[model samples]
Target: MDDTEPVRAEDGCRLWTDDTGHGKPLILCHGGPGLWDMFGAVATVLSARMRVIRWDQRGCGRSERREAEDRELAVLQWSADFADPATARGYAEQLADPWFGINYECNAAITAEERQVWRETELVTACRGLAVPTLIVDGAQDIRPRWAVDSLQEALPSATRVVLPHAGHVPWLEAPDEFRTAVVNFLCPA
Candidate 1:
């Protein structure tokens, strides 16, 4: 069974959430301050054995869109060689969809806030307190540096990191079978 609902935040923002299946709960958060829950396939597979909850971040996806101060930043363009051409093209097409509208203001604000938090907080120390098992999956060819993810995995006591060699930023899109297998093995060890 799949159920979707709007959850109100303390600040009164309505976040869109979908909950499915029936065992231990696993929340799937999409990447990007601008992206929504695009984990339908992952949810479907995992939901058979566990409750899967997917939610759009504030000001993103199906959540309530809010207007904020304009903060413009130059967009970074990747070279053609950055990722596999076909995979890159597929991602571009996905982004062109109306449902994939980019929320620049939300991205900028959240990015700025994240920078501040990173600078102000002892992230490693904070992560050390989190005892829950964590799966840190990364694409070996992602444009973003992997050191940060490596550090996170090192800090968390129960964290397991999986690096998919044949993928880029969005591993599931490029290597669906491998991605599904890795996630399933981690979430439902046999």
Candidate 2:
């Protein structure tokens, strides 16, 4: 186990990160704004050498829940608030609710009222360029839709992306070998 700390953003928002000092801060932003714990096997392997931070966003997993007033959510809101016009909405809406009925989906039952609130959110703006090298992995077949891949490329000019073609929404499951290779390379460079 490592130290978990809360970070205050410029807007007075609180976000948490696990700092293990494995290497540099390799923040792992899980897919679902609701699907919090999506990555594991790879994270376990990476944690052995780098400070991998997996945040549960504002409303899913264990990080924090949406306040009454902030009950709504958006794909952009979930994707670090990227306001860049060049950034693609790609599979944003499509991947938003793939596993809705599954027990794993978070906020699936948001009331009709909450849905309205979620509409108000304007998304934060693409993550302020990461300071350290970043690796973003998307499933080859990831309901990811074609445009989304293009948008991802636009967001992080320096980030490297790996798509597991045979894989679907979850690459770790479909293409474990390729996924593992991508994971290991990102965490421990040659």
Candidate 3:
């Protein structure tokens, strides 16, 4: 059974969410300052044995689309991150659509808060104490630096890191088979 609904946030934003299947609950979060849940296929397969829930971030996807106060900053950041001219051009074309509806304010605020947390928290130290097994799947071509992820993997005793080649920010979109294999191997190691 599939159930889609609007989950109202504490800030009064209605986030779009879809819940399906029925066993162990698994919440799949999309990664992005301006992206929606694109795990329909993944969810469908997992739903056979586990409950899968997917939600769009506030001001993204089917959720509320709030106006961004500064589009130039977002554009500049996007361009700077995708340093490769061809990649930047492709991203620029994608962002040209009104449907992108990026929430620059939300992105900025979240980034600021993340920076503050990184400054104040000893994440590496905390990871050292975590006994849980962690699988860090990273896209080789992700704009974000890989050093941070490398550091986390170094810190965690049972952490396994898999970098998918030819995949950018979203590995599943570009390397679905490899991504699936990595995750399945991690979850059902033989």
Model-by-model lDDT, in order? 0.76, 0.57, 0.77
TM-score: model 3 vs. ground truth? 0.47
TM-score, every prediction:
0.54, 0.36, 0.47
C-alpha lDDT of candidate 1 relative to the true structure: 0.76
Worst 10 residues of 3 by lDDT: 67-76
In model 1, which regions exceed 4 Å deviation?
Answer: 1-82
In candidate 2, stretches whose alpha carbon ends up further than 4 angstroms from where it belongs are 1-124
Ranking by TM-score: 1, 3, 2
User: RMSD for each model, in Å, please?
Assistant: 21.6, 22.1, 21.0
Give the best candidate by TM-score. 1
* Candidate 2 residue lDDT tens string, 1-190: 4766766656555665555547776877778536675555667778888876776676566555544213235455433322222332433344455523223234465555467654322211343254456687775444436776666565555778887666555555445698899989988989
Candidate 2 global Cα RMSD: 22.1
Alpha carbon deviation, residue 157, candidate 2 (Å): 4.0
Which of the predicted structures, 1 or 3, would earn the higher lDDT when compared with the native? 3
